[model samples]
Target: MIHRLFRHIDAGTTSYTDETGANPVSSYTCADRLDRERRTLFRDTPLLVGFSGRVAKAGDYVVEEIDGRSILITRDREGAVHAFHNVCSHRAAPVAQGSGNARRFVCPYHAWTYGLDGTLQSIPDGRSFDGVCKSAHGLSEIPSAEKHGLIFIRPGGGDPIDVDRHLAGLERDMAAYGFDRFHHYRSLTIERQMNWKLCPETFMEGYHLQYLHRESVGPIFFSNLMAFDSFGPHTRLTLPRRRIMELRDRPEEDWRLIPETAIIYNFFPNVTMVVQAGHVEMWRSYPSGDATDRCKVQVSVFTPEAVETEKARKYYEKNIDLAIRTVDGEDFPLSEAIQSGHAARAHETLIYGRNEPALTHFHASLNGALGA
Candidate 1:
């Protein structure tokens, strides 16, 4: 079934096409293109990176990986959000390991210190260079912006694009998910042996829900699925039936009250979000490099009541754990096997069934962007 609902593009048209007939694989999936997209999307433009749920306050911080670059996102004393290259300027050490609260980041290597605002506070050798320019050598500041409870960052020291412009239709639908009202309950990371594209592509449609996820998640969703709408490179797919709670013998009344059982938001290039009834989870996949075709998938879970109560917190945590086991334990291993099979000298072009419209759309977008 076709669920086509087009939203008018209000912003001035931005061209996204390749001149050459030769379609270049996504710069996101391509190793050589990492520097380009990183510069353009993360460094030059304010791309959404985090949510303003639990960590929206001053001194709250999280470590994120965007386009293969590790980033440390922090809110300053004044509650202003900022981002920096998570790598220490001194000795190239990783400034922060995982997510936590920090007033200052001290590099585990050589003990170089930096303020929460990305200012280089002190170096071990204060006397070594008497007049060394410290102001010019602070931690590289990545442009960042906060909107609708989401934190965005531009990684490549470039100019930033308007966040609202990028989030046009997404904002409306996401608001319906109560994204702004939700709090961050849990976050998890999964290392997959497959290409980054494989991860998002896996959730692009519900065609595989009945076949691949039958035991774990299949029995809960509808057989006939619909995907509607595309803005720029982003797309959203809506699942009609209440498959998730079906296993629990949930009543139709409960289903009717729920906004959507499944809503998958594909943010062009690498990120994808799965909006469920109770929580919203986002996955950012980064290709390890160009040649290997291996990628890392980072999953962040957000709920509307993480900081509210202990029971709410546990509920979110349990939900996150179930999701991780299903995706990482089941989906990822299969994807990895597929990638390896595709890479074999004996294989040719991979095939996509007609029912897999999401995957088809993804490939079409990839081809268009890369000039394939």
Candidate 2:
């Protein structure tokens, strides 16, 4: 963004990092430490689940799984967004199945119904219970908020989730994109045998871009040289294209932040966003369950414009395919292989290079969140 660029120019540097190096090993491989992070850092924190376009209409709703919690987020007729535990009030069965336009969510177990506002509407057999208070039970509400065209919820099923406070000023810069106006294109949810934290680290640095993605997006981006900034626990990493220098002579009003650079917002703990000219890709990783060794990623791509033509659709389809190959094919395979070493009782500590400051900041934030 121009704002960020100006700040970088003012500082006379893209970013800063202490040249002193440190080794962090237990945080990555220790099962107990991983569990602590899952409980304190990932679960208690508000997570970016989906974009606003997902539930754009009054009745549009989406079902998401966050850290093993089934979250049901919906937009009421009043154009207000609400979130609740996906389980039915009775027998704890899932109230909503997948995501679609629905006035009410019916439990497949016994037909217990709930309104879009999360109110208990009816029961199949009202007389089945002697003393039942229908009004006393509704879908358990969770903290949720819709802002800047994105949806966030706290999976801990607590009171109102203060999503704004969590951003810590990153919201102002993030709102510039007007993500709420974007269109959700396609998504892929895949299960993998890898630590949840390692998956996101793969996207935080350009050190690997040249080596791991050299055959794919590497050539298109200026690898190794990147601009970084830290906001609370969040990180802004800019991988400027070789053409970014063209903006130096152009008028400020005529400059465009996207296409000329690959800006990545690493929303600590789980969400990572890649903002480009045509679209934005959000990758959210959730711990599969109590198993720290397993994780799942929900990859959703949003386009500022509709893919109305067959060629456009094919381009996106091919884009997603290539992204999968670059990550699943090249990056994740290496992550899994690296994770295997954690159990071999070989390396005790892994070093964080000065060049990979974003990675270092991320791990430090994660550690601080876990009260390490």
Candidate 3:
């Protein structure tokens, strides 16, 4: 990471683009396009649903709503993670409600019971069914896996996903951070008035940091000086902190990645994995109820080790608070204004500057995924 930083510095420039510009307004803003995206892109592709630490033990489970699909994720006694459609085979009512440790999930509507592994265990009445196969009527399993401490699930119309391949070999690189060993500390979910893409897009670049975050995070980090590395549809954006210049006096061998540079990994579709000084922050955005104009952002923080003291806890608390204020207080309000502009058709087409190559690659890749 430091090598790349110095490379950009030596070249007297950060990453760049040719004169071939891109239209920012060229997005899936219409209802039809959003429907198609939900059906084809999100449904058929693998999605990072939760951090593995969320269900760190046997009998632990969590119910997540992803793109209109209610999903039940569980870790069984044997320590295997399973994902299933939360719907009961009996009356289609959800077998699981929220999150907790459960030997088995029982449908709240009736008495239909399901094992943690998603098998139908019992039905209150056996005679009520006519030619029903209990084994065949278990909860429908979604293509999912717990890889590198992250749970991935495909909701509908998709083939099984090879998580390693899907990550474009990032699993090996991410091992250095020990994401699987990290403990989830906190999470916050909020509804936004902008499109889901806007949330991740806002994080893909630091070009706006000097301006948008000038008072908050801007002074601490460089603006528009970023290095982009693509791993298939996923990308890693390395933005150095102002303190990174301190490494100049030290030997190149003493250079370290963490604490020096803030690495932002864009896990394609929605997840933004931010490597902070000592912990990790994951921000996930989901399209709301098939609407293109609205989305939900579920942000979480994970630590390599638990914050054992009030001072440590307060430090993390302040960091997260700063992030919340910067994004929700500053960035999101701008997103709302941009959404209003788009709604009013303010510009025939918005343009991405040559400096914003990450946005260019993202939208282009999105268009490819949508088969535009």
Candidate 4:
């Protein structure tokens, strides 16, 4: 991949699709389209919820509400991962809140307790009803699995997650990163006034780096150049940094791709995994509510190893801060304007240039899924 990227830089060419693609503006601005996507893409599919390191120990759990559906992910005593709907069997109250280690999740609404495995442990007052079966009332399980250091859940719940099938052939590349051992650094959730799809689109292509991010992160990377490939509905982009040119002088045996450039894996629908030089970043975007014009994005950073010292924590903190500033301050402002333009009816369709093949593939896959 690095060699291909170097050749692109040397020839002033970039990876491109056969031709330009056009997508209807309604794909972003229509509520009906958003609803269909939430059903097919977000609920039925195995969405990337988080990393394995977040729930590294027994009783550790995290609660995340994606696209308005609350999900609970837990690690049991036997070192197994599980996911649930987070709603209590009694009166539908959320059994888990935020994140922490707890042997039991007790619903604040009525004290209905659940085990780490999501089994209903006990009722506040047993025998209130004639014959309510505790075994049948456990938290509704959401199809989940842990793979390649990542946690995925199908919110609507169905068959068990087949990690290899879900990832297609991208598992081999993801396994190389050793993400299971990567330590969580920090995360920020920011509300954006834009469609959910538009959020990840910003990271899909390098075409805008030299112009949009010229003063921020542009100069560090080669403009409009990347190594792109697709695995099923997913896409992988290897964006070469300007410094990658120096690799031509070094021996091929010494070439290291991970540290030399940014590798982005855009999982179908809504997850983006970016492998940076020293750390990894995961971005998850979801619709804010029923609205097509609003969405929320969570950006989390991870270090190669756990931070044991204050200095190490501060170092990663600064890294995440820079990332937040570059996206929140620079990229988002324009995305918001683009969203506003859609509302203004300036154009009925948005064109994806051949150079932006990742965006083309993303929208095409999204539309295909929605239609299916």
Q: How many steric clashes between backbone atoms does each model show?
A: 16, 1, 0, 0
- lDDT of each residue in 1-372, candidate 4, tens digit only: 887887898799899999999988888888888889888888899898778888888999988878898889999999899998889898998888888999999999989899999998998779785498899999988888998899888888888999889898999987877889987776778899999988889999999999989888889888899999999899999998888878889999999887779898888879888888878888899998889989989887888888889998788777677777888999888999999999988899999999999989998788788774
Please, what are the lDDT tens digits per residue for candidate 2 over residues 209-316?
A: 878888988887666667888899999888777677678798888888786888888887788898877678888888777776788998888988777899999887
Native-to-model Cα distance after best TM-score fit, residue 222 in candidate 3, in Å: 0.8
lDDT of 3 by residue, 9-50 (tens): 667677777854666463636887788778876788899877
Candidate 4 wrong stretches, greater than 4 Å: none
Over 1-372, each residue of candidate 1 has an lDDT whose tens digit, in order, gives 211211111221111222212222343244555444444433454456657874667888888876677888888888888888888786788888777788888999888888888888888878985776777667787778777777777677666546667775776665555566667766766776776778888777666777778777766666445545676667877765443434236654454423535778887767788877777888877766444467777778887665577887677767677777778877888888877665563433455555455555676766565454
- Candidate 2 residue-wise lDDT at 349: 77
Off by over 4 Å in 2: 1-16, 248-252
Best by TM-score: 4
- Please list the C-alpha lDDT of all candidates, in the order they appear: 0.67, 0.81, 0.83, 0.87
**Pairs of residues at least 3 apart in sequence or in different chains that clash in candidate 4:** none
Ten consecutive residues with minimal summed lDDT in candidate 4?
315-324
lDDT of 3: 0.83
CA deviation > 4 Å runs, candidate 1: 1-47, 123-125, 175-178, 242-260, 307-310, 345-347
Worst 10 residues of 1 by lDDT: 1-10
> Ten residues in a row with the worst lDDT in model 3?
19-28
Pick the winner on lDDT between candidates 3 and 4: 4
